[model samples]
Target chain A: MDATTVTTWMREIETSVTQERDRLVQLDAAIGDGDHGTNMTRGFAAVVQALSQDQEAPPGRLLILAGRTLVSSVGGASGPLWGSALRSGGRVLGDQATFDGPQLVEVLAAALASVKDLGAASVGDKTMVDALEPAVAALGRTVGEGASLADALEAAAAAAEAGMRSTIPLQARKGRASYLGERSIGHQDPGATSTALMIRALQRAAAASS
Target chain B: MAIQTKPRKFLNDPADVVKESLAGLAAAHGDLLRYDRAAQIIVCKDAPRAGKVALVSGGGSGHEPLHGGFVGRGMLDAACPGEVFTSPVPDQMLAATKAVDGGAGVVHIVKNYTGDVLNFKMAAEDAADDGIRVASVVIDDDVAVQDSLYTAGRRGVGATVLAEKIAGAAAEKGASLDKVADTVKRVNERARSFGVALSSCVPPASGKPIFELPEGEIELGIGIHGEPGRRRAALGSASEVVDVMVEAVISDLKARAGSQVLAFVNGMGGTPQLELYLLYGEVDRKLRAAGVVPVRNLVGSYITSLEMAGASLTVLQLDDELTELWDAPVHTPALRWGV
Candidate 1:
């Protein structure tokens, strides 16, 4: 994908996150800290502003800027987690003027590893990793099966949605959800829900490009 | 219950109270701390040289001595202070990362609250964009909430202090950022906490209680935000209160025989140390009987709820590394040891 296309995708994700901001926060209020929507919204808004101002910036730089914006604007645990994911992903992409499906996969793998390294949270922790791990795995699987970028991302988004749904019955082992112990079960993870939104945003971006 | 009125006169505008207080705090404790008033960054005066992984944390005001008082050698590299009860915006945290981040990346330590977590994450992203490697650890130790349908999950409480202390030492010992993050995650896994609120905290600006509670009633498992607890019951003696709080914490920890644990008896605010000590005494006795060895102990107001009268307990299973870090010397305004 080219820089312009990636930028369009980010803007679409920002819009989606804003549209569902309150819903995400509502979900979080049920079983996590009640600021997921606000945090994600603010971070993406910052990214939009940065990208608008620096349209000439390369794809890697744009993603890096977006990551920084999230880190600075968001204030919950997810802020850092998502911020690290984006920043690590951007770093892996380097200054590439454009990228392909395999390139995107490589970047995503690095980003996921960075988040895992930083949060030290595994998939079953019932945080965003629940959604992220599945999405990444789906993307890898699609590519291994020789699917196009659009197909892989579509599959990833679906897996992420499934992962988000799976969090409903999980007793969180990470972040504020863990504090609830048994109480944390039976509610969808707000982070997972947001992760699905991010993946869906990517799908939309890829479709628009196609 | 009716609200009580009191004279209010301390410094400049109420909006600037926290900033002014931090200024005075830094001035008084300059020997032990280095304060960046503009950035609201507080670090150990004699911080270790570059190359050591830096541990930084932050949150809103009123939880004084928390993100601030915890700054010192073998503790936090920097502590960013936000507005009262509000998460520090991105600018403050970004400034903190730049100030303390040596060539070695910085680790941002955050609490479990949505605002705090989100803001810190933004800051880490900002740092990385600036070509600084940054990692973050979120602490969610409260066991008061059901973690279910009614609220936004569990709040970060007592275990935060212990996590910072232990994790800070680990970073100081030259652990990589990834390693420190892992250690922090391990501690979070083993730690559980519960709290009680006897009174509500009044924000500095409004000077009004966030919520109301009856004179003879206590809110069980109340969050730091004056959120309703699981249940409210008639107030009981200090020992009885300890029994209820300890029971919740122990059960949450899934306490079993021979578990080595770290116990912290933390005051919410107005609760005096005398009462805290008594509560700790009861807690210690019960823990001993349960066949759990209390490895490291901290008693005082490490975390608070404005001027609320209450306390919380955090119990974390300990290993050799955590115990050693816990035992390490830390010099901060609120907590001092191994001096």
Candidate 2:
């Protein structure tokens, strides 16, 4: 996608976080510090504001800028996890004016790898990786099968929804929620849920662009 | 479900809490510290002491007098305070690391939390990229939590106080970065802590107590960040609570008969000094009976959860060297002796 497309994706994330803030906060309150919603909302608002300052930035630079803003403003685990994820994705997409399904898959894979590295989390850890890993895999599968970017994103978003639901009964193994151990079970992981929202936002952005 | 109540705090606004508190600290200890308004770091007045190993430590902000309050002559060279109960960013840590590098290298004393460890790890990498040698030790001394095989290893709590003291002293003594990191790790290995909460704490951003505690109930093995502890039970007498805490810490520490210990009874911010002192007496009695003798002790609110009415017992298995480090001259706003 182009710079404008990337900016739209960020604005879409801001809207999603704003709309789902309380749900994410309530979920975190069940197992964490009760601020994932607020943190995401704050981080993305700054990302949108920052992107406005450099509207003509390349796709990679736009994402790196957004990631840096999240790292500075989020002030929680999400700061580094999502920050590094976007930064990694941007670095992989370097200098591309526009990319296709293969590049999107590569970007998602790089994001997942960065998040897993930064958070030391993998599938079933009940973190953002829970949703992100599945989304990346789904996007890769659809794209490898010659699907369009919009269709691949839609598949990834659906898989992320399923991954988000998967956290409902798993005990948290990372983040503030992990401190609760068994108490964290039965609660939807706030990070995973927000990540599902984020992936869906990407799907919508891709659909609109296509 | 029950209705939650807003916590009562004296603040001009929720967003300004950390900044305002840091400003007040700078105002109160101008000679000892310089607060960086833009970077939001607390640096000792005489930092970058040539030929000395610089010690840097930080985490979330709600734990007052922790990384910041202890920045002084024999303690930390700098501390990066994050939003309340949130880990500080790598940028802040980078600034602190750069500000305190003394050519001998720098040591980062990180608490073992996912956020704290991750951010510190990033900052350490960034600093290393900048060609500054950095050594880091993640203290995980809380017996209430498990190890790294499953969960993030034990949450680093009360022992951070002793670690900062020992590491700071070692750095001030011109020890190499390795020596300071080694000494701090030793203290972490020898220390164990257990905390209990009689009430919940509030994050100003939310304005409500993080969790609801019914009347006459207490949470045992609570996290310093207001995470409900291992178990909740009916509130018991001070002596009864201290007995449980002592037993858990001693058992986890493996402190046997004739073992000398430094006992630190830390209040969870809202608790008064009288209560902490009384609990220390109980801790002392129980430790003596358990054959773990307390040769030195500190009873006060040092590492705290904002306005949470509780206390934690930290017992450091002491040797002559550690005790010497503990008694080393220190001058800080929250701690001062032998100055």
RMSD of 1: 8.3
With candidate 1 superimposed using the best TM-score fit, by how many Å does residue B46's alpha carbon deviate from the native?
A: 3.8
Q: What does candidate 1's lDDT look like per residue over A1-210, in tens digits?
A: 878877887899899999997687567656543556766777788888888998787788888888877766565566667777888888877887988888888878877897787777788778788898999999999999999888899999999999999998887777655655666778899888989998999999888987
Per-prediction share of native contacts kept = 0.28, 0.52
Q: Ten-residue segment with the worst summed lDDT in candidate 2 chain A?
A: A26-35
Q: Point out the worst 10-residue segment of candidate 1 chain A by lDDT.
A: A28-37
Which candidate's DockQ is highest? 2
Second chain only: TM-score per model?
0.94, 0.97
Give a tens-digit lDDT track for model 1, residues B143-165. Answer: 87656543445677777788888
Tell me the lDDT of model 2 at A82. Answer: 90
Q: Against the true structure, whose lDDT is highest?
A: 2
